[model samples]
Target: MLNSINTNPGALLALQNLNATNTELTTTQSRINTGKKIANAKDNGAIWSMAKMQSASSSSLNAVKDSLQRGQSTIDVALAAGDTITDLLMKMKEKALAASDTSLNSTSLKALKADFDSLRDQITKAAENAKFNGVSLVAGSAKPLVFLANADGGNFTVNAQTLGLQGLGLSTTGTTFTTAAEAGSMISKMTAALLTATNKLSALGTASTGLDTHLTFIGKLQDSLDAGVGNLVDADLAKESAKLQSLQTKQQLGVQALSIANQSPQSILSLFKG
Candidate 1:
């Protein structure tokens, strides 16, 4: 090979190889540091875009889960209140049956009526106080509770159930048991009210179960989406670690080769001296 002091082809070739090795080294280091094979759109545009979209979907599912949780809590409150009302109605029925006995004195009938009225008032109080986050399902409200069901703008609804005195076909002014006839009339009303409250409580229980099921499904769906994104972009750290060491070794060797090439022009001086 002909060599000259003004231009050294070997050194230029060595420099080019070294620059290539440096570029590869930078890429490997970035993979190790970021723990992602495709950290940005430039790395792999199609895969990066897909992973980003899936990540956004996973994030949106978080809101859906939260809405379901709130709905579940509201239903839970209503169920608890409904159960209390059911128990109160059962006790009121017992009082009305006792008051209906013609053998009972006036004083005894009045006492039973007082007890029945107190229990009826408690039922109204329970229904009114069954609120969660300003929402009450059994308080005679007409609004239904709606919750996000998925990332695709879907929703779940729980229709409101009124459990008030008027809603249960009872008198808001309280029932009277002043005579055997009045007490007998109250027994029929109590039976109907008990049935109505039980049916509404059952409906609320079903809604609660549905919310729980969907919440579980949302959690699993989010996990699957996150795993999909990871599969698309997450780096294999073990492979990157090995490649990093290899590239670093290559970089050092490249530098040494360039130094040797730069010294080759000095060999031509030895020929002149001899």
Candidate 2:
């Protein structure tokens, strides 16, 4: 049974080869244009998920670091104001000692009293106005600020301890001192006040140090998160360069293969002439 259908085997093979070459060319073009092997979720699901998680972690850690820095600044301002108040109180004590000297004239003593009163008022004013980011740490107004490290808790919370000056009888005016001895008596009452202020300053320093330590740990966590994110999504120039070279080579080979496939139908002409 000799059938007379004119079907060329080379032409069919050429069409198949051409389709394969075209497919490879398309894939190489996609990789080159997009600059990513795994451009979509369907490409590599696990890597995509990991990259997303790393990105999210980096964002959260960055926010936490910003908050910690602001907290540190707030603590610094409060500590400085506290120390200033203590210094002013020390100066007032020196003036009070001068006022109690019997050799000083009455006018001189009254002048010293006026200066002492002004210094006391300034101390009170400083305490009342000492605020950071609108949150007061002195004058017994602000709530205790807390910082927690992890989800399970068990982190440090720095409390704003009182300086214990509630009964010092240290006021600007209204109380009369009859003599130098009476004025001198007030120093004993003020002794506890000065000591308490000094102690509070020390406590503030300790608390500030603790905050700084915690912030340092937070910064380390942020650095780790940044590294993880970079590892996940950042472009590897060395690997990318190699892949690009391979893709370019494959593209050239595909073009050559396609040209040969297109020329395969010409071979049928030779068979026809024979």
Candidate 3:
């Protein structure tokens, strides 16, 4: 080989190796500082894209959980009202039976009617007041209460049936009793009304239970998705720490190698002196 004075190939190769080690050191430090292996798409395109999509979906599922919780509250209120109304109906039944007797006069019948009216009014108020977040599941809106059950708004839904005085057969416009004979005829109607209210309570109870189960499931699902995203995007700190120490040590060796290569041309000077 012809020894060239102008250029040293060994020194150039050592410099290149040093620069490569420096670049690797920078990357390892960045991973340590940020705690993310793929901080951006530039780091790893496919992994970054998948992580972004999963993160957005997790965010959307959180919103759905909120909606489901609100819906559950509304259903709970309606259920409470229905249960109260059912108890009131039982009281009304007692009053109706007492007034249906021939032994009761006009005054007693009128008093019984007043007590019955009071119970009916209370039932109306209960139904009307059963609202959550401005939504009355038991009154006004006949439409079923719909809640998002999934991350995507289009996919799944939970529905609760609407209930009210009319739905419960406790509407004030019906079954008025003026006389003892009329009161006697209304006993069966009151019993039927109580049955209807009990049934409505059952339906609400079933729906509330379903919402609770779904909420639990959704919570676990979110946890899994988060873990998955973290696995894909989060840096392995232990591994990165080891890599950083290795890179730093390697960089020092690279610098020493380059210095030795630069000194090699000095050996050629010894040949000229001899």
Candidate 4:
């Protein structure tokens, strides 16, 4: 220690310590307010870049989820139409059997024929109306619905199924039966058509189930990725709360230390007091 008023080394050291303490306090306050340890590149450039990249990836996955949801809707509409068509097919089968009876009165046979024709028209209407977002999966359209399976959208795509009744070997005309022998012949053809329709329904059911399974996996994966990003950037408020108290106390001590250091120069005045 030198007894000189020209320079105060202790005071200089105290000021530097105070400045350092203030810098730390500012950073702590920022974390408290923002609740993010890496709020910007100034905090930690490397970590901020990593967080941004992960956020972009999560956003891409969200887009994929959106596409999948639309695809689900489209498939659901087609499946519902398929179900209605199956019911109509069953009714038509019953009509064909009744028409095959060799002893039925002409009036009764004619009534069955009219009912069969009405059902065929209904099947056609159902297929035409089974549409979503302009996508008619069951209307014999060549428009293939594609869904994204990944964020990049480069090598991942899922094609949805398109269904049509006439394409599935189901007769859309009710004029096939004329006589008893002809009605008998239609039995085998109708059975085959029903079998084909059943198989197509099963296939669609399987495809729809696969999409649901993938959706579940995607939802879980998105959650995990979100958590990972949070881990990299989120601040621990509990830890910050403790640090806030400690820094406030240390800041007060720093100011007092600087005051005490400044008072040392005043001691030189004591020598000249007399």
Top model number, lDDT? 1
Order the candidate numbers by TM-score, best to worst.
1, 4, 3, 2
Model 3, span 71-148: residue lDDT tens: 778887888877787888888888889889999888989999899878878877877788887787677464577788
TM-score per candidate: 0.96, 0.79, 0.89, 0.94
In model 1, the Cα lDDT at residue 137 comes to 93
For all predictions, the C-alpha RMSD in Å is: 1.4, 4.2, 2.3, 1.8
- In model 3, the clashing pairs are 138-163
Query: Which model is ahead, 1 or 3, in terms of TM-score?
Result: 1
lDDT of 1 at 86: 90
Pairs that collide, model 2? none
Once superposed on the true structure, which residue ranges of model 2 sit more than 4 Å away at CA?
1-40, 147-156, 162-178
The ten-residue window of minimal lDDT in model 3 covers 154-163
Per-residue lDDT for 126-186 in model 2, tens only? Answer: 7767777786566646567765553234355666744313423455563225357766865
Among the numbered candidates, top TM-score falls to: 1
| Model 4 worst lDDT window (10 residues) | 154-163
What's the residue-level lDDT of 100 in candidate 4? Answer: 90
How do these models rank on lDDT, best leading? 1, 3, 4, 2
On a 0 to 1 TM-score scale, where does candidate 2 land against the true structure?
0.79
List model 4 lDDT by residue over 41-117, tens digit each: 98899999998998888878888888888878888888898898778777877888889999988888888878877
Per-model CA lDDT versus the true structure: 0.90, 0.65, 0.82, 0.79
